[model samples]
Target: MTIAMPVLRPKSPHFSSGPCAKRPGWSPKKLNTSVLGRSHRSKEGKARLKLAIDLTREVLQVPADYLIGIVPASDTGAVEMAMWSMLGERGVDILAWESFGEGWANDALKQLKLDDVRVIDAPYGRLPKLKQVDGVARDVIFTWNGTTSGVRVPNADFIAADRQGVVICDATSAAFAQALDWPKLDVVTYSWQKVLGGEAAHGMLILSPRAVKRLETYKPSWPLPKIFRLTSGGKLIAGIFQGETINTPSMLAVEDYIDALEWAKGIGGLPALMKRADGNLRVLNRWVTATPWVEFLAVDKKTRSNTSVCLTISDQAVVALGAEGQAAFAKAMVARLEKEGVAFDIGHYRDAPPGLRIWCGATVQSRDLKALTPWLDWAFALTRAEFCKVAA
Candidate 1:
């Protein structure tokens, strides 16, 4: 049996989960207004930085009282700043369902070495028991979307409205594409390079009023790195939230982000962005429903991620190869697709189950996903045949 290769290909063959595809019609020309070669503290540079902050608040609909700041490093720096400054005041509960979430957990237990910490974790494809989280006494840290496992917390209902502890969220992959419950979270972190398709090395940290209070009242026992310092004396750094970044930022990347924010607004803000990601997922859903060769990695429909849509080979013959062989087969299929110019960077995360992880973020076009599916079928068939011959 043979599957004919599709003559059509994705108009843009980028499906990487990070440093994702730029917005439709994006290019270096769009960044001409960048305040290059100017001090970020200068009036012109500060205005551009302020515009980025203002646009983020407007587009994300962040609560009126919450503060947003541009920080050094990507989302990792943002998350670490929140943890180091705020966690020692209270007992902490860390949750992990995938690599990024797990990374935060390791930071809490190993690096920070908080004594009164409880970790709730689940394997790659499933979420931990949300009901088990101790909202009454312990601050909580978790990822809203697990980029590697293609799973996400369904909603914020599990968070108690009267929770005594702060909730810090690493939403690098979830922010613009998913609706976040601002009141439920005390600290939230994301990077420009994820859903918005902007350049990397800058992180956005959003702080609720409670998070700010924590910063003002409690200082960590550890020495704060210059990059991670969020407070001055006994008060919050008001300037940080008002375009005064802790460190220098790339004016070129700032311009790129401003461009992306404008694109997001032009397309109707967060709802439109979510619709784009959802539409990409629906396209993959239709393909998965009809195709017997693959299935979603996240078994639970409600928890399946609309952004990082992961899939595993389900054909009986492919399943028989076991984990290592199946990983090799998936790599071969990915390479073939890349060679054909249909898709790139579709392979699963290195530590995840062997499968494909396709970025279905707001910047990805549904039509491109449609064009890529048949190519996936063709690649799978070609790779499967190669494996069978070796076995024979």
Candidate 2:
């Protein structure tokens, strides 16, 4: 059962969901190096940071009133800061359908120890019941896109438009690639490394007026770390949102992010980014629709992610091997692709079900995905044959 190897390979196979493929024409030389050695607090340095923020607002089309800030640690830090600063203000509703979402749920139930917390969850490949959320009375926390499970909320229709509480969203994998319902979200967080394919460690935290009001009014019962502090003297730290970061930042990373933002702006802003991502997903969807051996991990098409497109083996022969065997087969297929230099980092998230998670973000060219599918079929055919022989 020797499968013929595909002659064509993807032009770029740097699809590791995080620190994803750099923009189509990214280069180190394109970055502004002037900010590299300057102190982030210096006027020149702060201007670079401010430019990144301004471009983000322009690219994302965030409401003029919403505040955008580059926070410490990345998306995780931004989420934690929001959770610690605001969750205890009212009863909370947390939703989980993937690892990152579950992690946030654990923080509320285990670490934060909030008094009135309700956790609504679903297994991988499916979304939680959005109707179960009580956003009107309780603060809501959820991820707009589940990077691991490859599921995403289709829209924010379930969230009340006139709710009393705030909605905190981890949009790390969705920003730029998807249109976020800004009016429904109070606190949205993302990282430079995910959608735009920028350098890591820096986080973009966008806060609505409601979130800022919570920060200025309610102080958390637990002690706050300096990095997590967002307020002073019973007023919002307006400076943080204005590029005056709480701690010194990586000026190099800031410049790289600014480079990415500028690139995004040059390419027709948010609409173009979403179209590119959607086009990539369409390429995968057409392949999946025609390929019986594979199907999306996200059960529902409506909730399927355009960015982190997760897929699971549908071949009954592979499924009969049980969980460990299926995982091994999937890994072998991934390894074969990697070894052939056809694709890299296409394996499932460690915490997710046994499957393949291909990053189809905006930075990934659709032609690469179309070229990669035949290689996937070639790899799977060869891997299945080897696995069957081992089982026999």
Best-matching candidate per lDDT: 2
Model 1 poorest 10 in a row by lDDT = 383-392
Candidate 2: pairs in clash: none
Q: Candidate 2, which segments miss by more than 4 Å at Cα?
A: 390-392
Estimate the TM-score for candidate 1.
0.98
TM-scores of the models, in the given order?
Answer: 0.98, 0.98
What is the lDDT for 53 in model 1? Answer: 96
Each prediction's whole-model lDDT (CA): 0.91, 0.92
lDDT of 2 by residue, 1-392 (tens): 45678888899988789989999888999888986778899999888888889999999999999999999999999999999888898899999999998999999989999889898999999999999999788899999999999999999998999999999999999999998999999999999999899888988899999999999989889999899999989988888888899899999888888888888899999999999999999999999999999999999999999999999999989999899999999999999999988899999999988989999998999999999999999888888888876432
Worst 10 residues of 2 by lDDT: 383-392
Total clashes in model 2, counting residue pairs 3 or more apart in sequence or in different chains: 0
